[model samples]
Target: MNELAFTSWTESTWVGFDTETTGVNPNEDLLVTASLVLLAEGVKGDLSQVETANWLADPGVEIPEVAAQVHGISTEQARAEGRPLGEVCGEVAERIVDLWRSGAILVGFNLAYDIRILEHSLEVCGLTSLEERAGGYGPMVDPLVWDRKLEPYRRGRRNLETLCGVYEVSLDDRFHQADVDALATLGVLAAMVALYPSVRTLGREELTDYTAAAHQAWAEQFNRYLASQGRDANVEEYWP
Candidate 1:
């Protein structure tokens, strides 16, 4: 176990996770593409040396035009080339557990969405839940979650592309590709830790706890904002 309480964030193994899915609703969306990668930053997101796995699934449903527009994966393409969701989800869970068991922290943008949706997919395929498979989610480093905590006053949309620019990382044309998104999220994470001295000093487990609490605070504040706007607040209020 990495018992060190003050390891440099850039000096540790990070497992980046991302997915291109059928929609935004975790309870309803299907994962179309997913990527998991093991990397340590060499000046940031330089993925020249990395171990990675990616999966494309048929999802057993039509891809919505809007989603396909964003991700560039048509239902025709997925049906023609994708694997069964059963094999895909099982393999993904196994890889994730394998990486996390060895002490690699999970890193991503807004990762809870992908994870919860993946758990739903596993249920659809009768596979074990990721929580059950891994026992629990490990130490995590979510740039999206942390960014909200660190810079709540930062203006504009919080999309990956926008935040990537805010962090001075070049995302280019890879906005929706799962592998690219995962790697870019890793870069964003590296940048955030480098910028936030307070976070840089934390152990992975400590930071995970901190992010979880920050996420809950953000959710509650957002729900209050939504209520004031006279809309139903239905965001997921817990971590995956």
Candidate 2:
């Protein structure tokens, strides 16, 4: 099979994605909200050219207080205002698949977690997973993985807020809201590309492969560190 030709990062379309969930475990937690921001080529920062979608899911479970505090979505509010879990998951999955099929690269902060949570949500809702629908997860860009690999030595913390600070991306106090986070991820990516022009030169496939390998390398190193500390070393060595 001939591989599809891919444009450079600066010239490509990007779908910035994010999800706020009930908890951290993708396998068990439910998706409370999700956002997708589309940044078209040559108009990356222009609000008029950008397209956006946000979903609020009832999740069919009580929103934990801690999770509620993080994302500011309560179960009562969700029950009253959010759509059904299956309907929201199905629509989100379909939108993502359509964008991927149209050759838009997926962008996210820490994408693996969001992807896994969406995949699990689809399964729970009896809908097709994104992997199955999109054929594969690739042609994706994760700013978190890129930042860790690019600046491995200089880091106090690597969370989204910290990265936004490091990259000079403006993120207000509404950090955990899916839409805000997704947009911030896009800004951070732009900043990274500006600081590291070499990344913008790589083709889409090359960038995906590079980031995947970088993520696996980081996972392996971190797991070894955990083992050295006599803790369970269970970080999954995979990228979204």
Q: What does the lDDT read for residue 187 in candidate 2? A: 81
Model 2 lDDT per residue over 1-240, tens place? 013222355657888999999999998999999999998872145434568899999999999999999999999999999999999999998998888777788898889899999999999988888888878766788889988888999849888888888878775548999988888888888777767756766876786798899999999999999999999999999876
Candidate 1 C-alpha error for residue 239, in Å: 1.7
Residues 1-240 of candidate 1: C-alpha lDDT, one tens digit per residue: 123234554566788899998998888888899999788642243556778888999999999999999989999999999999888888888988887787677887888888888999999888889988878777777788888989999888998888888888775456789888888887777677667677767766686788888899899999999989999997667865
lDDT for model 2, please: 0.84
Candidate 2 stretches with Cα past 4 Å from truth are: 1-7, 42-44, 47-49
TM-score of each: 0.91, 0.92
Stretch of 10 with least lDDT, candidate 1:
1-10
